[model samples]
Target chain A: MSRIHHLPLHVEFGDCDPAGIVWFPNFFRWFDAGSRRFFVACGVPTWKELEKTTGIIGTPLVDTQARFVRPASYGDEIVVETSIPEWRTKSFVMKHRILRGEELLCECNEVRVFAQRTGADPHAIRAVPIPEDIRALCG
Target chain B: MSRIHHLPLHVEFGDCDPAGIVWFPNFFRWFDAGSRRFFVACGVPTWKELEKTTGIIGTPLVDTQARFVRPASYGDEIVVETSIPEWRTKSFVMKHRILRGEELLCECNEVRVFAQRTGADPHAIRAVPIPEDIRALCG
Candidate 1:
């Protein structure tokens, strides 16, 4: 069985829109944090540390899809459940489900790659092959 | 031909991550803004105004997918071109492309619905049929 990481968060007033519900983009922010927390829970080093050793600055998404099931509002306590369901040679899929108690709020699946700075162009980045040690640690 | 709206925005310093690239979530935020801008450009009323008359709160995403082609950073002037490619009975597909000059940064397609408050549950929302007059205005 794949390991799962749960990150708990609270919805703040600033997180909501005039509609009185959390802005949709904030869900993506929590998913990003959940992704990093998953790696940390698996004994993976910080992206900054890995950057020095492996030139891997971070896991950046190539593509992502999300389904918003239900609306959530401020003062709600939510948890992001993250897991890696698939891995490829150079990319992997990270899944995150946000829930309040037993109610699912949103779910996302992201295809991400381990990215490194490319050449001298600050905006240029290239995906590198999945690191064996990192994969092992995560598994 | 479908109407296309272009929303120009400046990437602020705080928009970039430690990697110096615009974090992916910010892309979605821009897309949402672009979606609204598209409607306004088509002479559609604001969500607040629609809510008062039609009980429609806003266009809420049911599903959204995005592909990141190139990274953008602070100081980049980006334009999000938004168009509605398809419309259904209750949902529509909104497409957005983020470009810096002639360079493509990212693209997204979202399936969204006009949402209204459901019952007495403050957090509950329900998708409503696409209003004919509103659709005509957007078209």
Candidate 2:
């Protein structure tokens, strides 16, 4: 079974727009943070450290779909529940459900790939096959 | 003819990650801004103004899908091109293409609805039908 992770966050004033609701992109940010936390809980190293140890830089998102279920305001405490439901040769699917108290605020699914820096360009990135050790760590 | 609106932005240091690439969520933020700009360019009133004239509060996203094509970094100047390609009675599709020079960074399509404050709860919201005046303004 894949491990799940939960990241709790306190929304701040800057996280909201003039509408007094949390800006939508902040949900994506929380989801991304939840994703990273999931990996860390699985004993995975930071992308910076992994780059030197395994040449695996980071998981870059290729596609994402999200739905807004409810609106959240500043000062609301939210939790992002994240899990990896599927894994492929080079990519994986991450599912995130954001909740406030008993209410589900938003949800999203992301398709991301294990990537490696290509050439010497700092910005050049390419996907690499899933490493056996990493998969085992997550499982 | 359906008009397109372009909103230009400069990537800031806070917008990037340790990897020196733009965090994906920032793209959503820019797209949201572009969505607002699209209406502004078409002479639509602000949500605050419309709240008094009509019960409509704001355009809230129901669903969104995005594809990341390229990575951008701080100091990069980018533009989000937004247009409404489809309109329904209550919701419409907002499409955005984020570009840096000739390079496409990301693209997204969002389904958003005109919303109104529901009940006395400040965060409670409900979708409203597309207003004729607003639709005409967009056109």
What total of clashing residue pairs does each candidate reach? 0, 0
Q: What is the C-alpha lDDT of each candidate?
A: 0.93, 0.90
Compare the candidates by DockQ and give the number of the best one: 1
TM-score of 2: 0.95
Model 2 lDDT, residue A28, Cα: 92
- Cα lDDT tens digits, model 2, A1-139, are 6787988899999998777788899899899999999999999899989989877778889999999989998889989999999999989999999999899999999999998878665568888999888899999
Q: Which stretches of candidate 2 lie over 4 Å from their true place?
A: none
Candidate 1 reaches a DockQ of 0.87
**Which 10 successive residues of model 2 chain B have the least lDDT summed?**
B116-125
TM-scores for every predicted model: 0.98, 0.95
In candidate 1, which residue ranges exceed 4 Å CA deviation?
Answer: none
